[model samples]
Target: MPNCNAHDPYTQVASISIADYDYPLPESRIAQAPCAPRDAAKLLVDGPSRPIDAHFSHLNDYLPPASPLVVNDSKVIHARLAMQRSSGGRFELFLLEPIEPASYEAMFAARGPVRWHCLMGRAQRWRDDTALTLGSHPDETLRARRIPPHTGGEGIVELSWATGETFAELLDRLGQIPIPPYLGRCATADDNQWYQTVYARHEGSVAAPTAGLHLTAPLLRTLEDAGHPILHTTLHVGAGTFLPVKGDSIGAHPMHSERTVITRRLLQGLLAASAPVVAVGTTSMRTLESLYWLGAQLIDSQGPAALHLPQWTPYQTDRTPPTAESLQALLKRMDTLRVDTLEASTSLIIAPGYTFHVANALITNFHQPRSTLLLLVAALIGARWRALYDHALRGDYRFLSYGDGMILFNRNCKKA
Candidate 1:
C-alpha cells in the first residue's frame, strides 16, 4: 500500500526542491498524436495486485462503482489570430481572456469593439499606436489596437470589426485552435475536431482538458449504464497550463488564475455522493477542490461578495470543516444570491503538502516532468507517483497531451 502521510500543515513541501520531481523523458516517448479511436488509448489502472495496463474502454472496470465522474466541459476556442501591420510586418495575437465585460458569455456576444487580455508575438515590432488589421472587406474587417498593460505586463488588445457578427463568430472565421506548443507542429484542419473533447459546450478555454479528450460518447454512455453519474464544471484552461516552474523550489513559482463555473446541480451531486468523486482532468480536480476552500471562506470569514480564491489560501490554515458542512455553506450562499451557477476564479496550487477536500480519484494523461501537474499527482499518492510514472514509461505508453491516461486512487481517500 502507498503511504498517505505526505500532508504537512506548515507547507514545508512548498520549499522542497522542484528537482525532486524531475524525471528523464526521452523525446521518443512523447506522443505527437492521439490514438486512432480515442477510447482505444491505453489506461494505467491501480489494480488489486499492482498497477494494471488496460485499455481506456475498460475504465468502468477500475472505477469505484457509482462514483460520479466529474468532467471539465469548458470548450477550447479558436483564439490564435495572425494579422499584419501597415508596414507588412506580421504578428500573432493569442486571446487570453475577456477584460472589458469580464464575463466570457457577455464578451463573446458583444458586437463591435471589445477588450481582451492578449499576448502578442513580436509585440516590440508593432508600434503602440498602429493597429493590426485582417480581412478583405470593410464590413468583415477585424482590427486590434493596443491598450495599457496590466500590472503583470500582459498586453491588452481591443478587437473591433465593422460587421454585426459577434466576437465568437469573428474568431471562428479567423482564429486557429491553440494546441499545446510541445506538439511541435501547427494546428491542422484535423485539430479543429481532434483537439476538442466530445462533451465540450462552453467556449472559453484556449486549451482542451486533455484527459477528457480520450472519452467518446459511447464510452461515456457505458459509464452511465454502469451507474456512474457524469457531472460537469468549467475551468477555462489558460496558456499558464504550459508555463514552466522557473524557480528551483515550488514556493517561488506563481500559479495562474483561471475562470471557473460550477452549477447548482453539479454541487448537489457532489454533496450527495457516497463515494469519492472521479475528476476527469487536472482542471476539473482544481475546480472541485477550490469549491471547498471557497465554501470554507463563507463559514470561517465574512465571505467576499464574489468568489476569488488565492493560491496560498489552502496552505494558510488547517481549519478544514467537514466536507458536507463546507458544501452546505456554498448552497446557502447560492440561495441567498438567488443564482443557479457560481462564477469564480482560482489560483489554487495543489502540491504534496496540500490536503484535498474533494475528488479522490483522477483520470488524467501523463504530464510533463517537473510540472505543477506532476506535483499534483505526488500530492495524492506520495513517493509512489514516481514509481507509477516509471511503470508507464517502461511499458512504452505514450506521454503528454496526446498520450495514454491513468486512473489514480488517492491513498488518503477511499479506493475503488
Candidate 2:
C-alpha cells in the first residue's frame, strides 16, 4: 500500500496525480454497439502538426512505411459465467485469469477441473457453501466451489464439468460476452461476433482489444500490399482493464496484472523491421512497451530463463537496455534456452512522464475518463491529448470499446 510507483533515478520528470488526466465524457457518447462495416467508423489522426479528422476507411492513407503495425492477437473469451445458488439466488463469476496453468493457451485447452481468479457478482449471496450450479449443456452441468479470497473482493473459484469440451469451448457454450459496463446493457447475440476482432486467435482476454476492431480484412490486405506486414503478440487483457483508479495518485492505484506472450519471430521482426513500430491498441502498446522493460530486466540479470515484471518495475528500476539491444538480448536468451516463446505477466502502469521505446505511434480507441489508457495517451502526446479528446467529443466520435478510433504520434517520447 506504500508508494509502489516511486520515481526512478533514471527519470528526472515529476510525477503527476491521477486527477491531472481526468476528462469529461457524456454517457450518450458511449457506443453501445460497433459501427456496421467495421472500417467505416470514424478515425482521428493526430500528428506533430494539426489533428486530422477522418474515417477509418482512409486509415491506409496515414501509414508511415517505416513503422509496421503490431497488434494484440489475444482473443476475448466468454468470461462471464452465470449460475444460481442452492437458494436459487443468481450470481455471476467473471474469470480474470487462470490460477492453475496460468497460461492462456493451456487454460483454454485445459479439460478437467480448473481454478481461476474471479470477480463474483452479488458476492455476499454465495459466500457460504451454497453450491452454485450452471446448466451449460443438456448433457453436462457445471459447478463452482469458492476458495478463500486472495485479496479485496475477488476470490479464487474452482470449476468442474462432465463434458469433454475444453474450458474455452465450455465458456463459449454457456458464458456471456463481457462488455463494457458503461454500456448499461447486457451483451446481445450480435456482440458475440462484433466484439471480437477479425484477427483474434488466442483466447484469454476478458475484454477485446477494441482498437483492432477497426481494421477489416481488406484494410489489412491493403496495409500488407502497401508493404507493412501486421505482426502479432498476445496479451490476455484482465477484468481489471475496465476498473477505475481508486487511488488519489496514479502511483497508489494497484495496477492490474495481465499475461503477455511474445514469440522469437515477433521479437526478430520488431528489431529488423525498417519501419517504426505502431501499436494497434493500448493493450498492444502496453505489451510492446513492457517488452522493453522485461528485456531490460533480462539484460541486467544476464538473461534469466524465467522472468517476472512487478507492477512498479518501470518506475523503480534504473537498469534499462536500449530498445534494439533489449530486444536483441531477449531474442538471444530465447534462442539459447531453445524456447520459441517467452511468457510473462505485466502490471506496468504507463503514465505521463514515462519514456517510450518501442512504438513510435499508437492507434487506439477513445478511452474512459480517469483510466490508465488516457495516461498512456498523455505519455505519448502530453497536453495535446486534451485537445484530441475535445475534438473527438465535439466531432461526435463514438467512444469506448465499441467506439471509433484515433492515431497519435509518439511525439513526446525521449530519444533512446
Candidate 3:
C-alpha cells in the first residue's frame, strides 16, 4: 500500500502526462545482444536515500541479507513462424497462445489441425486459402486463415501441420525466437539460449521474463546457500507487453490481459514469507498484485466478477485489504473450492499513485519510453524513474530485453 491514501489512485491528479515519461534514447543505446556471461550485466540499485550502480553478479550486495525472490518461469517458445505464399510472398506468424485447446499441455500435444491466436507481419497479402509450407517438407504445410483481432491490432491465424509431432516440436523445427522489434534485427542462433532464462521450464510466453536472465545457476545456488528462497509462478507474456502506450493519459488506455497461474503451494510460500518478497520481473509483480485483487474479489464474490481485473481496477475504488487479509481470503476460497491452483487473467495497470499490494522490491530490465512498463517502474518509486533512467544511461548501461538489469525498492512495508 502507498504511504499516503488521501488522494485517489484513479486520476493520480499530480502525475505528469505521457510526454513527461518520454526521454531521448538513441537506437544505439538499445542492447542488440545479451552480455556474454548473463550475470555480468550491470545492476542499478536504488534505496530510500541513494542509488548505486553495480554488476548483477553482485546482486546480494544490494538486496536484504535474505528474502523471497518470486520469479516468472514462463518459457519463451519459438513463437515466430515463417510462411510462404504461393506467390513466394513471405509472411511472418508469431503464435500468441493456443485458443482451441487453451491448455498449454494439450495444445502442445494436439496433433492434427489446431487454431491459435497469432500476430502477422504481412497480413494484408494473405488469404484464407493460401497454403504455407514449412521446412521444405510437404507434411509441414498449413493454411493462413484469419480470425477477428483479439485487441490492439493483433490478428489470429489458424494453422495445422500433418506430422505427428506436437506443436512444440513443430515450432522447435520451424519457428524462430520472437525477438522484440525494437532490437531492429532478426532473431539469431545466440537468442535461442540467451533470450531465455536458465530456469525456464514451462513453454508459453512469446517473450522472456528478462530479469530472470541474470540469475545463472551458480548465482541461484549461491542465493539458496545464503538462505533466500526462490519461488516461481507463470505469466505467459503476450506480444502486447512490447506495445507502447499511445494515449496521452494512461487512464484512457486499455490494458492487455495475460494468462497467469499461481499454485496453492506458491501462494502458501508467498503468504508465509518471513522476509521481503522481491518480484523478479514486472510480469511477476503484476501477478502478485493481481493475486491480491483476486483474493479481494473472492472475499465478496457476487459471481464471476472475481475473475476479471479491469484496467483501472486498482484505482477505481479506495477500499482494499491490508495485504494479510487478501491472502487469507484467497486461501479460504481455494480451500472451499478444494483446488490447489488459481488460474486467471489479469489486465491490471500499475500507474503512478497505484498502491502496491505485494512485491516490496523489483528486479527488471530497462524499458522503453512511454511504455506501460515504464509506468510500472514509476509506480514503484514515483518520479524517480527519470533519474534512474538517466543514471542507467550515463553509466553506459544497455537498455531493453537482453540488456542490463536494475533493482529498486518501495518504501518499507511489512511482509505479506
Q: Write the per-residue lDDT of candidate 1 for residues 1-416, one digit (tens) a residue.
A: 21234555434766778899999999899988899799999999966458999999899999998999999999999999998887888889899989988899998898878998988888777777899998877677899998965443358889899888898888988899998998889999889998999999899999899999999999999999999999999999998999888899887788889999878998899988987799999999999899998999999975888888988888777688888887888889889889988888999999988778789989999999889999998887788888889999899999999999999988786321
lDDT of 2 by residue, 246-275 (tens): 777665577778888889878988878776
lDDT of 3 by residue, 359-416 (tens): 8899999999998899889888887898989988888999999889899888744444
**lDDT value, candidate 2, whole model:** 0.84
Clash totals for all models, in order? 0, 4, 0
Q: What is each predicted model's overall lDDT from 0 to 1? A: 0.88, 0.84, 0.81
How does residue 396 of candidate 3 score in lDDT?
94
Candidate 2's displacement at residue 65, Å, is 1.8
List RMSD in Å for every model shown: 3.6, 2.4, 3.2
**N/CA/C clash count, model 3:** 0
Ranking by lDDT: 1, 2, 3
| TM-score-better candidate, 2 vs 3 | 2
Between 1 and 3, whose TM-score is larger? 1
Any runs in candidate 3 off by more than 4 Å, and if so which?
Answer: 1-8, 13-16, 147-154, 302-306, 412-416
